[model samples]
Target: MNAFWNRWRKQLAWESVPAGTVEGRADRDPAVGPALTDELERVLTPVMRPCAGIALAGAAESPIHSFLTGHPYLPAGTTWPEGAAGPQIFVGQINFAEVASVGALPGFPRTGLLQWFVDADDTYGLTFDRSAGTAGFSTRWYADPSTAAGSPQPDAPTPTDTVDDLPMEFVGPTALQFRHSISIPDWSGLPAQHRSDPIWERLAAALGERRADPEFVYEEYVRGGSSLLDQLRTASKVGGYPSFTQDDPRGTGSYPAADSGQAELIIELDSIDVGGWGDSGVAHLFGDPAALATGGLTSIRYHWDCL
Candidate 1:
């Protein structure tokens, strides 16, 4: 089996919070407890119903601890709001054998894995398709509805300003940002037959033979030049995942600016075939080269903060 497949299979078997148990657990928290419950009931419940037999896991003590604690793409020391309570995340996963379970759900494809994040505020949800290497995420934050009737809404920026021109400042104290990523190992050392995919052919031609050296590094895709979010948006439009537009309540329609000072690269790997391993599209390639040679993606880390 491909190393990535093995790793994901192991994760699927890891201990997880039982399905239908998150609501009761949220009740224990004092700060964000009620909000979590409300979010799950009002927002997530209906959204997740189609994913029959979906299992839930808590990430607080999972192997992804370091990522949740200190993500490289987020500001340093990023943590949940001080004294905030409730599970930081509830991972929803459909077993690999049951990939077809969610096929009837809008925007979901028939893939071996369908995982997503459900946060305390219930304001954000991210869906990751492991088989397709695609992700769809949406976040919404606003004042409590009871007091929002007459509140002044943030002015929608003039259409003239591109996303790159938007301010990088944090949106609010309750808003959270999350990312799902995958990494492709070094292709330079792979046999020539493994590099025959047309997409690889184009990538190699574009990089030129000399620049293809293992140490030369090709990060244009990582630096946001490849427009990862845009690809997600396109995939969403094509029913690959649910569509999230800026017009939705408090939704930004795209990832906020990277505060960790590293360029956020969400590369799209179309027609990717790994010698009977599988293929995917719109993959987010993490920017580390050392981890690539192993032939599996790093954890699909999920990070969020109150800011």
Candidate 2:
């Protein structure tokens, strides 16, 4: 990763904006109202263009602006290059009840206010998880296709820890940046025969056919497994895996319900490595109670790096 991304990887703790802050500001401050409108237009124009029945500009009555605006936190005068195509906008669904449940995971907020920006070359996103007491930013550049094709290492070198000292300024108070050490479970420590266990077989199956290098599978599994194990630990503390009834009693089954236990697990697991195994992957792995129970895997061995 480059210096730009190195800074973004760290989750920064920022002061929370109370509910109604944005709405109140829009009502009272004229600048705030236009700024909100301008921003929504700037951010959402590209995303709505390809779809019909969506209007992004003007005094036209549209739910698009109403939904996109009123975010408590707004970007601080950041703009894409002039005349350049606008970045795509993505809004994450908010579940207030779930937000109230988890409270906060170690490095993640119980609730997240998400906004994403994507252009042809790079992707950027900002989110506030008040429950986690953090406002986080992330970016990934697609400029280097080679990086994706390169051999996956046993572990990539720790990106230089540069977020803490960057001179960049934001609209709010200076946020504190934290570096979390990546933790990987020591699968090697398992008895040679344990590799053949039913649980490992199931997990390997869930991982699907391994077209990638065998070494990459092993390394990625170890890396991704660390966070997975951590989530299971947290879930155990908060009340074990969520309960899910089989509605079909035959089909692949429904996704796990959005509950406190599941929410906390997802947050902490995602925090492990910002751009690593994504939210869907994490959810799929832990969503099933049966898979986790098979191996008696909760106390697996692991190591931590505190960079």
Candidate 3:
């Protein structure tokens, strides 16, 4: 995810008030937050971020805290996470203690078992909320997994999102390995402040494009060595820039960004094998940097989109 967008990173000086609170609990809300000006892009440093690329190994060795799918570990005293419909389907989890041993992401939790589950029935657990906030999708975190001694299976029936006659069920109880890497933001995942920085034109001008169609300029940037976006190994990852098949789910009337710096990507679970979202897209959980730094898991939001 590293590339052209790194030419400049800016901080806008608009005096809009912040809308979403940084406190524990809940999803995203439209922010009356700051906006970046074109001038700021010229002086600010570039935004190159560090992230861990996740690869699905074979079946998990055990139920113990580790990055894996299908098999979920329920901590002692914790009830299964249920969404609006009924019981939620287990997605996967990350044992950050293991993550800390390998790579790192700024402000993310260093220890704990951060697990994910989504709503059953229709819509694949998405609430359809413009901001994609709310408990439509649930994320559970156990600061310590000492008591989580049992592996879990889907309490609800698996969804049948057969595409083109390709049958589907659950991804797998596959073990996962994390390799530390660097990532850069995409046109759609640029910071809120930078959205108004006329990047499309800047990119076009950089390529000396006489036509300058926003979409065409980007295609050229990726092909012209300005960005390795098309080659980034982030189909699955933690704490990296987001990759959306559709539009940037923030600030607009539809997809809203998390409060201020609170919406950084926590995890990106792309549809793999048997698991699919709509027409096969990625699911992302963004959390508040403040809470993440303190290892608190309640402050977060859920979002998924497809082409």
Among the numbered candidates, top lDDT falls to 3
RMSD (CA, Å), each prediction: 23.7, 26.3, 13.1
- Per-residue CA lDDT of model 3 for 118-234, tens digit only, reads 777566666655535555777776666763356454453433222122112445577778877666566554556654556666555433456566545543443224432433444
Cα lDDT, model 1, residue 63 = 19
TM-scores of the candidates are 0.19, 0.20, 0.66
**How high a TM-score does candidate 2 get?**
0.20
Better of 1 and 3 by TM-score: 3
Error of 1 at 274 (Å): 34
**Candidate 2 lDDT by residue in tens digits, 1-307:** 1221232222110022233543222123223323333332332223210100111222312111111111112323323221122322221112212333433323322232322222211112212132111112221111112312422233322111211211111111211112222222224323454333344433333334233343344334432332221111211011122111111111112222333132212212121221122222111122222222232222111111111
Models ranked on lDDT: 3, 1, 2
Model 3 lowest lDDT segment of ten: 8-17
Query: After superposing candidate 1, which stretches have Cα over 4 Å from the reference?
Result: 1-168, 171-203, 206-209, 213-307
Error of 1 at 82 (Å): 10
Model 1 lDDT tens row, 1-307: 1332343333232134244452222112133323323322232122122222111122322211111111111122323221122323322222222333323422233332222323233232233234211232311111111222322223422111221211111111111112222222223322454344243333333333334432232223211234211111222011121111111111122332332212122121121211110122222222111222122224222222221
List, in order, the clash count of every candidate structure: 1, 4, 2
Q: In terms of TM-score, which candidate is strongest?
A: 3
What is residue 110's positional error in candidate 1, in angstroms? 18
TM-score of 3: 0.66
